[model samples]
Target: QLDAVPSFRMAVHPHIGTRSLDLVSERDKVGFETVLTSAKLMIQEKLSVGSISAHLADKYNLFNNSVKKQREDLLGQISSVESGKAATSQSSKCSHVVGHQAACCIKFGSNIQFRASTPEERESVPPPISKERGLVVREETCDALLALLTGLKGDTCKTLCLETARNEMKNAGDDNSLICDLTLLSFVRHCVEMGAVALH
Candidate 1:
């Protein structure tokens, strides 16, 4: 059984307020990267599907157990508060005084707004490497082109084959999303050329 470490719990619940959910803390990043690395190793070693299934089951069980513990703790707190209120009401009745119901709602701040940071604020953190930035741009462009060529046929299929060939040549060095997308597009184009109808 996997233990529920604080870092993993933080990964499970990263958001604290109205922060961008897409942005994760360094701890969450570490946890996710660890899991991803393990999964990659499992794939490379040709591990059985049941091995991966069991790994996923453990993670899910951790999440479910954490949620259950939180629910039980919350209910216990509510019960204690209600009992305290009932005792207060009883004492108030003996003294012929009115008892007030205590509000037990939890409040969260909603005043935060999202915005791009100023250059000065961004200066603290170093920018991504040029190669990394280039890779991201290339990946986005390839994804857009793939979306356009999703349902290619006839003249469109030929045009996409040419485009995919060009992209594959340009992206041959890097094994990134663009290369994957181009490969998929090339496969689809070949299938269409081979009299296979593109459905949807």
Candidate 2:
């Protein structure tokens, strides 16, 4: 965005006005003022603040658009990280197990553990889920966000959540077999990245 407009930058931090441009005169004494624009009648005489303001607006608008596009793209990416077409080798269900999905995707708070039909089923994934404290959705959301930061997506952990959810149904002994390992967190991460957020 700053590629044009002479040597101007679209975003001049407030600190720049206070620190770098501090102890300065009203005019372009150190070129800091030129970082954006000088006075109304300083540049080329023909240059108008209206033109500069319009140019800056366009650049900022473009930046915002780019950010928005990226967010949508990320949402789509995370949405399909676990492709519906990419099914497991065995289209199986947790026998005599039950599954329940989270209220929503972000995992903002509340660490919930899905119970099992029998104490044995809980150990299938090792270290059976014992009744414990719940984490707020925000904590889980932060963890999910941090997941994208690392080389590995927090998907495995997300997988565990889904597994636990489905496994809880097994604990109930419903045998519906509607278990899926997709975490809405993955999708939410995509949403945040692409900037198509809920604004909530």
TM per candidate comes to: 0.19, 0.20
Cα displacement (Å) at residue 191, model 1: 48
lDDT of 2 by residue, 97-185 (tens): 22221123333222322211222332332221566332223332344333322312222233233334445345645433312123344
Task: Output the number of the TM-score-best candidate.
Answer: 2
Off by over 4 Å in 2: 1-44, 74-200
Number of the top lDDT candidate: 1
Clashes of each: 0, 23
Candidate 1's residue-wise lDDT over 1-200, tens digit each? 12333433334444524467457687766767787676566567766788889987888678657666545554464344445445444333342111111111110111111112223432433333444321122343465444433433223323323334446445544334334432343334333222232211
Model 1, runs deviating above 4 Å: 1-45, 77-200
Looking at model 2, report the run of 10 residues with the lowest lDDT sum: 94-103
- Clashing pairs for model 1 are none
lDDT of each: 0.38, 0.38
Candidate 1 whole-model C-alpha lDDT, 0 to 1:
0.38
